[model samples]
Target chain A: MRAALAASVLLVAASAAGWWLTRPPPEPPKVAEDQTFEDMDRAEYEAWMQELGYTD
Target chain B: MLLWLAVLLGMRFGAEHWLPALAAAAEQLDAGESMPVPPKPTGLASLPAPGTPGDGQRATLLSPATCEAMVADLRDVCWQSLARQVAPADPDEALRVCARVAGSEMVLECHADVAESIAVADRARAETICAAIESRKWRGQCFFGSGLALAETDAEYAMGRCAHAEVYQTFCRHDVVGEIALVDLPAAHAQCAREEGDWLTRKTCWHGIGKYLARRDTSEAAAACDASTAEWRGTCYHGVGWGGAERDADATLADCSTRGPYADHCRHGVAAQFKRADPTRAVALCESIQKADTRARCLDFVTR
Candidate 1:
């Protein structure tokens, strides 16, 4: 009985390892919808243009 | 182990290529075909030759120095970027910036912008800023400039102050109307439609709306003018034709041609526009104009 249990545990571990190795890799992380502006000038310029009715 | 290695390697390649791909996308987005044009911006009228400053260019920071350095198309970007950068944190400094600019017109533009910025905090000082301007020619610019900036936030108050101005009151109203139409067409229409002012003021207001409509929503131009009073409708279409003519002569004719009296005027405008490129074609256009007198005038104007 003890020998049978040990062999079963080993078999399960090997199968799990094989599945992990074979599964498709995750997709590259997606960019966030609202990324921060690159700089203060860009942020300020965009805000002013919005006020001028040039942007939504 | 091999699968894990492949996944990690794929991510590394993606990371390495990400910035370049983003940069390429950015370049394409900025292409002229994709540039977002707002409705009826008189400022954009200067886009073709952004070297010269135009109305509604009030918000740009393109000082004389910067403007001189840039080519025509890039100057618009310069104007867009710099509008708020050199705005006066102090009233005196604002004056200094204006003073540094050489031309009287530019000085007035500077003061007008500065005055408007100042008015946001202190209305009296803003007036004082304009009052300090030395040239009479620039006075109108200052008053209208302040009014234009004020219209962005407080249209009613800006209009009221412009109306109250001792001098340049008409200019004040016309310019304020131009800016207001940019934000709310119906409200501007109602304000302009009120029979309180002179015929010219009302007519000019409609013209301002026409210019706005021509830029913002091309399809709405005729409908908007159709809703106006008969006296000013032609005037409105005149500006509409003017705006359309900027894009194409055919666009002008298509937009402004009517069974109405303004048809000749609209044709004349197109001829004038065509005159710039092909004088012979412009003269041919003039001959097609219905009114004999206007046709003669257009022919002479184009030929000369």
Candidate 2:
């Protein structure tokens, strides 16, 4: 009876270890929310545009 | 005994799955790398349409109340128009009007615009006005704008005034020389020749020609660039690539491939121009470049 109990525990431990080891990597961190040009007031919009070399 | 056998078998299978991930994560850690987060795509649809009516013309004087009455989206422009109108007769009033602009940066930009407008009447006063700005960047921009306005009548004097622009000096020369090239190609080329010692100024000078002049005539642009000294020819070709890519990227890439020794630089230009509009395509194009250094350069510009 004791031998059977040990075998059962050992099987469960091995299965758990396998599951833990085989899990996929966590998803990548999310990017920050984007602020559209329309969301910006005129100054911010123009500065962003200028930075992107559009106004030149 | 059966359980022990199953455990060994499970561990073997688990190792297969976990090893690669561990190796990958370890490699990342070793390289001091994190997961790359791509920037969000910018919204370009709302940008103001170029060449709107009265786009470059001076606006008539308007009371502050009139400017205030304009839509919030356009009120700053109205304020700038008022400043420009007031600048010639009373620059101090123009500066005060610029102060009414919503943001500090825009206020400075308005001041720069007023200074440029003043340059049309009195270049010396424009210089004095530009020099008074506290921020170095805005002060440089002011000098550059005024210098550009001065270039219309006196290119050499305008170039001299551009020297006060500090870091923006090359940009001012680029436009001023570009403006000169628009009318006289040879004179622009000669001006660029005088900048031989300074790599940045000389390259940007040729770049201006490719940007402002090459777009008008491809064969002429090619010939003009071909006439450049061997050392700086690649930079001129890079400009041509930028100009060409702005209109048609695929066509520019095709042209770049035919450029032999200058091909990589041309490809770099095209990739840079396409970076904002189509980063994936830019990256793919970068991968196609033959030279490793240029390919890396192209990737750096696009991926960042």
Candidate 3:
């Protein structure tokens, strides 16, 4: 009876190890929320436009 | 057999827990709650039909009380119309009226945009209008806009006018020179030869020139880039690859080998360009990449 119990526990442990090893990748790093590709020229040009409730 | 069954069960159990977590995270990202509220645009959109009388213009024609009423409804449109009508007649007068209707920032922007608008046809008038601006910063912005407009009609005039924009000289030159150089390399180079300043500043203009010129004559553009000083050749060469990615992926990918540090960037750009239209070709191109990591990424994108 003791041998059977030991075998069962070993199987469960090995299975858990395999599952952990094959887990999915970690989440990707998030980009900044307020990121802007525009240079100063465009930024200044668009600030007032944006302030007036503009899109596109 | 039972051990194999346990392994399979373990895999299912792990997926059940982690899959939900991953999915929740993904949904959060898709919702875009991380980004700030996007600025709403109302100025041009709020304006009345083009060519038709804008509400602000009609308001001014009616009376100051009517114009004030228009401002109560739509301040941006009201001030914009007042700006355009009053600017031609009296720029200082336009600023005063626009200030009353809008915030301090918009007031300044109104003056600058108005000056530049007039500058498109008459640079001198724009300069004169800028002189009347109360603040130095507003005056520079006005002059910069004037330079940009002047570049469209005459690059030489833009160069001369941009020179006088002391606070915004570098930015003004970049805007004007970059604009002219995009379509007219000869004009840009001709001006660059005579006017000597910081090479870094001039590189901004040449970068756009090389990108445009590559579409017309790749070999000549490349040759011209080679003849240029080392100061600007890297960006100039990058432009060639960038332009090639837009129109000729194969040519760009083949040229990548000659570019050492910039090779992967060029190849990836080419791969991305071809990936959607002809994925088989994109996968084939990815196979030619020497960098293991870059190749893996390209393969994943094309295959996905």
Candidate 4:
């Protein structure tokens, strides 16, 4: 009986430790705002084009 | 996890604290530097006369630095290209380069691009960088970049990143899912089906498949769209129209009729593309749509 009890205790502890080891991370608050390409500078546009590989 | 949470909190709350420091450092560096003209490419034959047949092909091989020296007008573009190359490895130095840029928008773009570059290896750091950006537009672009890089391996995670991208979030899907579509088209479609969002989000997800696929092969893209569920078929067709417009707007508009029931939606997409450049043509195309609601939306796109 003592052996079974100890195994149960060990199992519970392991499960708890597992949960602690792999948990979902806390995320930042969601904020919403909008802007358009018209507001983008030519340099910024060029940078985007380069990022997209549209130009060298 | 605790440290990660703290870092996120710091980014959310303390961006203002670091920005000035970065600016000051940038200023110090800028003041110490001299604006010397960029050097010309060595070991290159000169005298490529303008309009020469091979001249344009050779220009494509020139480095950004060489281009900057050759075209004095587009100096900022050259700097941006140089910074883009530096961002993935040394973001701080890239930011310093961006800081000296005359335009504030370009500065924000530099930050966004740097965030994207680092996201390939360290997404957590990239998100922190994105959250700290002041402009909503650039922040979205930064997240979009992160999502694009992440999509190569874990598309679901990339979609999660897309959620953080502010106004440009819709476009993030357009490119991120579009990237996936280029590889496994069916999987891309399945992802769009499982995606949880508003109608616009769902529409853009499907649109991405059509847009990116159509860029490679129009007929295949069309077949892929036809294979999709009826609910999003029109959306995909619209994407095809948009893709085609990049090359030839007139041909794209004319080809819409071949789409049958979805033709009006295709025309709607074409009209949207033309709204900025040729509003009259866009309105005329909108008028051609038989569907009253779609026509109204197309007209709205043209007028607005």
Per-model chain B TM-scores are 0.61, 0.71, 0.53, 0.66
- Highest lDDT: give the candidate number: 2
- Fraction of native contacts, model 3: 0.16
**Which stretches of candidate 3 lie above 4 Å from their native place?**
A1-56, B1-74, B81-97, B211-230, B239-304
The DockQ value obtained for model 3 is 0.11
| Model 4: per-residue Cα lDDT over B1-304, one tens digit each | 5445544544543455555655655564454222111111110113232356764553355354563575544665666655655665577776776675556666777777767666766788888888999777677777777787667667778778777766556567667777777767776877887855665566667787777676666667778788776788887877777676766777776677787888887777777666556656778888988999989866765564
Residue range A1-56, candidate 4, lDDT tens digits: 99888866665555443433333212211222354434434444333322221211
Question: At residue B261, what lDDT does model 1 achieve?
Answer: 75
- The DockQ values of the predictions, listed in order, are 0.01, 0.09, 0.11, 0.03
Please give the CA lDDT of all the candidate structures.
0.55, 0.65, 0.57, 0.63
Predicted candidate 2 versus true structure: per-residue lDDT over B1-304, tens digit per residue: 7666666667778877788887877776444343322111111112222245553354434778899999986898888879977777789999999988886667877888888877867888888888888766667768777766765467677677667665456666767766666667787788888864255556667777765554565446566778776777776776777767777777777877777887777777777677666666778878887889878867865664
Q: Candidate 4: TM-score?
A: 0.58
Would you estimate the TM-scores of all the predictions?
0.53, 0.63, 0.47, 0.58
In the range B1-304, model 3's lDDT, one tens digit per residue, is: 7778777778778887678766776686555422222111011223343246664564355334556776354766667666766665566677677677555645666777678656654567788877777665566666767777666468888777666555445445545654566556678677655435554456544544455455555555565556555666655554555456676756766776666764654465466456556665777877877778867866765554
Please give the lDDT score at residue B48 for candidate 4.
38
**Candidate 1 Cα outliers beyond 4 Å, as residue runs:** A1-56, B1-84, B99-109, B117-124, B161-172, B257-262, B272-281, B291-304
Query: Which scores better on DockQ, 1 or 3?
Result: 3
- For model 2 chain B, give the 10-residue run with minimal summed lDDT: B37-46
Measured over the true interface residues after superposition, the C-alpha RMSD of each candidate is 22.5, 16.1, 13.2, 16.9
